[model samples]
Structures are given as C-alpha cells and as structure tokens.
Target: MYKDFGPTKAVTDMTLELKRGVVTGLVGENGSGKSTISSMISGVYPPTKGTMTYKGQPYSPKSVLDARKQGIQYLTQEQGTIDGMTVAENMFLGEEESLGKKGIVNIKKINARSAEILKENGLENVIPTKMVDDYSFEERKMIETARALSHQPEILIIDETTTALSQKGRDRIYEIIAEQKAKGTAVLIISHDLDEVKHLCDEVVVMRDGIYINTLTGGDIEPHNIRQNMIGREIDGSYYRADYECSYDEEVVLEVRNLSVSGIFEDISFELHKGEILGIGGLSECGMHELLKTVYGALKPSSGSVILKKNGVQLKNTTVSVKNKIAYIPKDRDKESLFQATSIKDNIVTAALDKLKKGFIITPSSERKMADKEAANIEVKMRDIEQQVRDLSGGNKQKVVIAKWMANDSRLFIMDCPTRGIDVGVKEKIYKLMNRLKNEGIAILMVSEEMMELIGMADRIITMKDGKLSKEFERSAGLTESTIISAIV
Candidate 1:
C-alpha cells in the first residue's frame, strides 16, 4: 500500500482466508499490515503482486460499491460516515435513490426508514433525526455500524468498529453475526480487543510486518499464544501499571459538590487527590461518558463546577483548566484526538507546542527531540517520526496520543476510554505511564468500559448508573472485578 509513497511495503505476499459460516479474526500490531489487509479486502487499494479470491473465483473490487456487491461491508477505523448529516441520513445515504423521487431527498421517508433500520438492528438509543455531531463519539460509532448493516450484506467485514460501542450496541451486532452464521455467511472481524475476538471468532489469523505468521484453531487458540505470534516474543503479564508509589500527602487535588448536567446526570460530586488514579465504570447507557466530558469542560454543565487544585487552589474556566496543568484525552481518537494523514511527530508534539514556541514561532529541532524521546519512551513502533499516523497500527496510534499528553506535562488528565482499541503491549505501556504520572503527583480521572482494566489500574473506582454516582471502591484495599461489576448496575 505504501510502495508509491516510499520504498517500503505495507503487506508483502500476504494471504488470508475466511471459511463460510465462521468468524475469522485478523490481529497484529500497528503498521503490521492489519489495516493494509483490510483495505485490500474492502477495495480501498489493490495488491501489488497477489490475488484475493472469494469462494472459488478470483475477485478484485475496484471501488467500495464493487466490494459491497460481493456481500462485503467495511467499517473503517477512520470516519466513514459524513459528519454534517443526521444519523439516519448517513445510514441510508447510498441507497436513498429508491426512497427519493427524481433525486430529491425525502426527509420524512429517510428518517422513518432510518429508524426502522436501526430498530431492526437492535439499536434503540440512537435517534434517527439527531445530527451526527450532537451524538457522543461512541454513539456515532454505532450509527456507522447501522449504516454498514443497511445493505444486509452476506460477508461482513468489520474493522476496529466495536471499540466505541456500549455493551448493548455490541451485543446487537454480534447477534446479527450469529444469525448470519446460521445462514452460512462468513464474517471477518479486525479488532484489537482480544476479549471480543476470543468470544466472537472461531479461528484466528496472526500477521506481522506484512507476513502471515500463523493461524491458530481449537487447541492452538489463546490470547498469549496469539500475542507471541504477532510480536514474535513473549509479552509481560499485566497490561495495567506495576511501578506505582502509593505514598503521597493527603492533599485534595480536586473537589466538586452537587454537580448536575440537567438531563444527562444529577447531583454529581466527587473529590480527587494528587497522585491518585480515579476510575469510572458502568453499563453503556449509565451516562459515565457524559459525566467525564463535563469534568474536562468539553461539555457544559447545567449546575456543576470542576475545581482543579494544586496544593489546594481552584482553577478557573476551560482554557485555564488546560493552561493550568489539565488535559482531556477524548474517548474517540479518530474524531477528537489524532489527525489521520498527519505525521506521528506532529500528533505527539501538537499538544506540547507551547513549550517549543518562542512568541509565535515553533522550534523544529527541539520539537523533534521531544517527540522522539516521548515516542521512544512509549515504545511507538514506527519506521520514522515523519510517517503519517493514519498508516500506523491501532496500538501505536494510542501510544502517540499518550505521548502527546505526557509531552504537555499535564497534572490532571481526564481520559475517557483511552485504551479502547489498542493491543496488549501498548496497554501495558499505558498502565506503566499512568503509574509513573500518579507517582509524580499527577491526578487522573479515567472513564472506561472495561471493568477489569478499571479494577486492575485504578487507585479508586467509582460507579455510575442513570447518570448518578452510585458506588465507590478503594483499590488500595484490594478490590475485585466481580465486586466492581456487581456495583455497576
């Protein structure tokens, strides 16, 4: 895929197969040819020296429609739906000619059909008429899934699409896949979420540096074995942090009282101390994401205030929050975080430009040095810092986001599902980085969908249900995932 851009290969002589009525998983590190393989299968690009066949015939799709006709749907990692359109508008975008008369869009019919489609697909929370922008990052992601599913394709190719979905949305699509399997339709899922793969996929295929490593089935199937095959080495035990220092003064770094965001959440209040990792977990519709965004000042609160303190001092507004040592790492990297097609160095160093700036000018040499150091520390596997982040792997892209925040030296970090779509190796580094930051007296407020990650990494865990803070746990006292999960609902 990168042969024209540079004298490098994205995938070299790679061959993959998916049997009928089976779910096949394609796993690899960032820039390890997972996306490249997905592109070739989805007709985004053609292979240089190989053929991709379906069933018993040689098949090649020149465009997205060609791939779609062959019973293939691609939920690309990048934004695949139009941003300005409503959820229903994007859902039936291409096939709207049937509903419209003389190419004139019929809003009434479009919305009705969209609602029907989503309802049929088991997505009831997604409003048919809501503007795509107003929906949260994860909500919009489910809308994308609904769009891909509008065609009812036989062979479903979902690439990193489930990271943003709530458990309900995820279950809806998985049920559809199960139905398709009964009808003898083959499914291909490309995801970094190992738990999903283990549950959904019957067989697994591992790829590395554009080469086919091995395919594990039955007895050969395990997360560790798959990881070792993909990275060609044994990995660490825990993805969460290890080197943490629990010794810190009992100084409160943040305090919020009787905070409420109208219909989203009510009576939201919490206190955060310096050198503490606070985690929030709940079901998909529990409003945990809305609460976190409000804390970061990304979303306005109707009657709540976020107070940031260093040795007990309240900071001012949103700008002051970021300027006075607070950073918000969004839940959706493609939408709110990294810029695809931009260089990795640019993504990493964009947040730290204030440090590299003199008046209005940026120092390139110093910026490069800082970016390189951060990337190295995070173990970002990239050929060059100048390489575009779009072509990098999911795990590597996440590391770049982490590197960006670390470069800025933010004291209080508000992260929502930061490790949603990354591999185990990168997840471990993130845990280590969080511990390092907490040890340095940096306060972290994290919201995650993964219950185990919250239990393993968090110093204190908070549970939200119906947009209200219902329960809290102290990890210092040794909390269990079962206890945490039980409290969530």
Candidate 2:
C-alpha cells in the first residue's frame, strides 16, 4: 500500500499479508506510518496507490462504515466514543437502521440489547442508558471495543489501544483477541510497547520512515531485536539508569498527608525527597493520574493536604504550585502540554512569561531567545522556533513540552506517562534528562504504566491498586517484572 499527503509520502509501497488465525504486530516509531497503514486498511483513509485483497478478492472501501459492513473494524488510538451520546447510541452509531423503523428509533430495545452486550463483555456496571461522558476513560475504551466486536469483524485493527487500558481491561482485550484467533479472524496490532506486541502477536513487522524494514516470527520476536529493527540501530544495554542506589537527599521536598479523593483514592500519603525520582505505578484506572492532578491542585481532594516545600515556602494550590516553580507534564501531551496551532516559541515561553518580560512589556526577542535556548537544551529537532508544534513529529513535540519546564527551571516535576507513545531513541533522551534533573536536586513524581520503566528509573517505586498503595519497592538490583506484576494484579 502507498499513501501520500501532498509532497510528503506517509507510506510507501508497503506490501503485507495477514494470515487467518494469526495476530500480526506492527512495530515502529511515531510517524513511521504504522497507524497510517492500519487506517488505510480500515478505510479511514484511501491509499494513493496499491491495492488490497481480502478473501482472494479485490477490496476497496470508501469509508469506515463501508469497511465495517464487510467485517473489518478499527479501534483507533484516541477515544472513539461520542461524549453526549449514551453507550447504546454510541455502540450502534452508524448501524442504527437495525434498531429503528421508518426513521423512528427504539431507544429502550436498543439500550436493553446494548446492556446485554456490555454484561457479556465484562462491563456490567456500565449502563447503556447512561451517557458515555459519565464513564471513565477505561470504561469508554471497553465500550469502543464492544462496539467493534458487535460487527463480528473478520479483520480487527487495534491501534495503540492497550496503552490507555488498565491490567483488567488489557486482559479482556487479550481474551477477545484469543477468541478471534480461534475463529480464524486476522488481527493487526499497532503498538510502541514491544512487550505487549511480543506477548500477543504471532509475527512482528517492523516499519521505519513509512517503509517496511523487516519481519520477525517465532524465536526472532524478542524485545531487543524488535527495538533494533524498528529504529534501524542497536540500543545500548544501559538505556535506562544503570545505578541501583538511591541518590536522593534525605530531606523531604514534597509531602502528601492522608490525601483522599472520595472514591478515587483514599489515604494516599507519600513523601518525595529532594532529587528523588519517585515512581508511581498502577493500572490505568488506579487513580494515579487523578492523584497527579490532586497533587497539582487541579483536582480538589476530599481530605488531607498536598504540601510542596520549596525555598522555605509551602504550595497549597495550583497558583501556589506554579509560583513555587512546580511543573507538570500530563499524560495527554497534545491536549494538555502543547498548543497545537501555535509556534514552538510560544509553547516554550508560556511557562517562563515572567522571565521574558522587559520592564513592563513582554519582549518578542526575549521570548525567541528563551525558546531557542531551551529547545537547544533539550535538542528539539525543528526547522526553527517559529515552526508550529503541530507540524513536528511526536518526539519533537514532546521535547517542546519538556522544554517549557526547562525554561521555567522547575524544582518539582509531576510527570504522568511522560514517555507513553515516544519511540525508544527519544525515550532514552528523556530518561537521561530526568536523571540530569534529579542530579540538579529537582524532585520528580513520575506516574507510569510501563513496569520496566519504573524498575529501571525509579529511586523508589509505589504500586497502586484499587485506589490504594499496594506495594512499595526501593531501587535495587533484585527488582523484577514478576514481583511488580504480582502487586499490580
């Protein structure tokens, strides 16, 4: 398949085959055309050249609905559910004709049917009559999956869906994929997570710069080999921090005491030491993300307090958090971090507005200089600081986000899934940057889903389960994935 966006070739002459009863993993860096290929196959976009054959016949779909009618469904990376609509409404969005007569919809019957489907798929608590917006992110993901499975698709394209899911949700998806394989349904999974791809896929196809590089099967489908093929180079063994000793100061920089967010998280108390990389690991819905917000004072906790002591002053709210030089790197960088339509200069200078002011007015020259310095510090690859961040690749955009904090010279950092969709090469740079910040006595509270990352980077790891701290592991050579998984599950 070939696809081009004006002068740029998004995908080039990529020939591939998905065998029946097999799960083919697509591994690549962001902007490498993995999602593009999956989107093309699911009829989200039309290929500029090349043809696709299904069941030994020419297959060309005009739209997503057209593809779904032919037993092909795609679960996109972003949230697929409509906000105002009910679960039943979102489930049968395009295929509403089956539940309606002469344009008159049968809401009660359709909802009943939807409820049944939800119950069967282990989503009993999700009411079909309730609006999708009322549900959690993980719940909405399950709804999208249920909708896809409703089509009884012969070919399923799951694009980076597991990243947003908790352990229970991911296990459900695995079960669905296993069942689909048993039914001889072909599955194509696009993921940055090599461990997930290795565990679920029968074969792995590596892509780079919109071109197919290599394919691995059986014994060749290992994490190191897949990483090498995807990036076209061998990564160093010490990609993460090599030292196991705790390098943090004994003095507490930030303290959370008996913090409770109603039903989300209860009595969550922890102390972050100066220069510490305090890692928070949990399932997606374990309230870790919410805890980050609460600590930042974005979400008001029902009880207890978040106290950030910096420069002998205490931070009590969002305003205080900002004034005290605390920075936040949210999980959704596109929505929370970068201004998509704005220039890279604007993004970098956003957090450092006070520093950019010349007398009474904020000078353009000051902004440019600050942006340039921080961008250079983080090694952000862009044409110029004037370039719109939306035009940059995922890694570059992320660098721009981090550059803002660097410009602010933040003392405390709260990062949630900082390297979620980032490629291995960029991940290494971010890891190095985090270590550098720790050495500079900047306390960091990192909330992440990747187990290996926590083990490799953290001075102390705290595992949350059912809105509570389940286990805590100090940095040591004896830390293992199995030990962490036991606490998580």
List per-prediction Cα lDDT, in the order shown. Answer: 0.79, 0.87
Model 2 Cα lDDT, one tens digit per residue, 272-363: 99999999998787899999999998889999888765455545577777777899998878767788999999999998888777688997
Best by lDDT: 2
Write model 1 residue lDDT over 353-470, tens digit each, in one string.
8888889999888888998999998888887899899877777888888888888888888888878777766777778788788888888889998987887778778899888888
Cα deviation of 438, candidate 2, in Å: 1.4
Q: State residue 361's C-alpha deviation in candidate 1, in Å.
A: 3.1
- Candidate 2 local lDDT, residue 143: 92
Task: Note the residue pairs that clash in candidate 1.
Answer: 30-393, 31-393
Can you list the residue pairs that collide in candidate 2? none
